[model samples]
Target: MNNADLRQVVHANSGTTCQELAEMFSVSHETIRLHLHQLGKTWKLSKWSHMN
Candidate 1:
């Protein structure tokens, strides 16, 4: 349940790109990647398709 806001955003927009998430959160894409990694998720096929 960490980063719940980010997780909700990801779930709401399953097709959102990393760059988009970064823009939305006013952070770097690398930060988004790190959060996703911490959340046990991953990017695949141009989307954050893997979730946990």
Candidate 2:
């Protein structure tokens, strides 16, 4: 997906893990992490939980 699309997905699923988002986007966990950062957001344990 594009950067804008990635940002929307991140915003919609704020509690999603990097690994999870990676799978959803068919990208690497690091790639998702980068996108999150690019979107002015960072994936944290509190923001991204396995429970969610």
Candidate 3:
């Protein structure tokens, strides 16, 4: 997905988990984390029970 689209989705669903995002985009969670980082967003894995 393009950066703009990802950014829009992230902003629209600020509370969504990385896994959910990965699944939505048909990518890996790590890829979502990298994209989020590039978009100046930080994801706290500790916030999600399944991630920990």
Candidate 4:
């Protein structure tokens, strides 16, 4: 899946971490972080707070 798709999953499960997401998507942790950064711009403040 693309970053946007992965971001949606992350959004739905706010407590999940970048590493977890990367594992789930079979991507690198840095890849997850990049998507998270892009997603963060549009993500709700409440959601962003869940990042570790």
Q: What tens-digit string does per-residue lDDT give for candidate 4 at 5-33?
A: 87578667876776787889999988777
After superposition, candidate 4 runs with Cα above 4 Å error = 41-52
Superior by lDDT: candidate 1 or candidate 2: 1
List TM-score per model, in order.
0.81, 0.73, 0.77, 0.67
lDDT of 1 by residue, 12-47 (tens): 877898889889999998998899888888877666
CA shift at 37, candidate 2, in angstroms? 1.1
Q: What tens-digit string does per-residue lDDT give for candidate 2 at 12-37?
A: 77777778888988999888777666
User: Could you tell me the lDDT of residue 4 within candidate 4?
Assistant: 74
Write down the TM-score for model 2: 0.73
What C-alpha lDDT values do all the predictions have? 0.83, 0.71, 0.74, 0.68
Better structure of 3 and 4 per TM-score = 3
Error of 3 at 16 (Å): 0.7
Q: In model 2, what are the clashing residue pairs, if there are any?
A: none
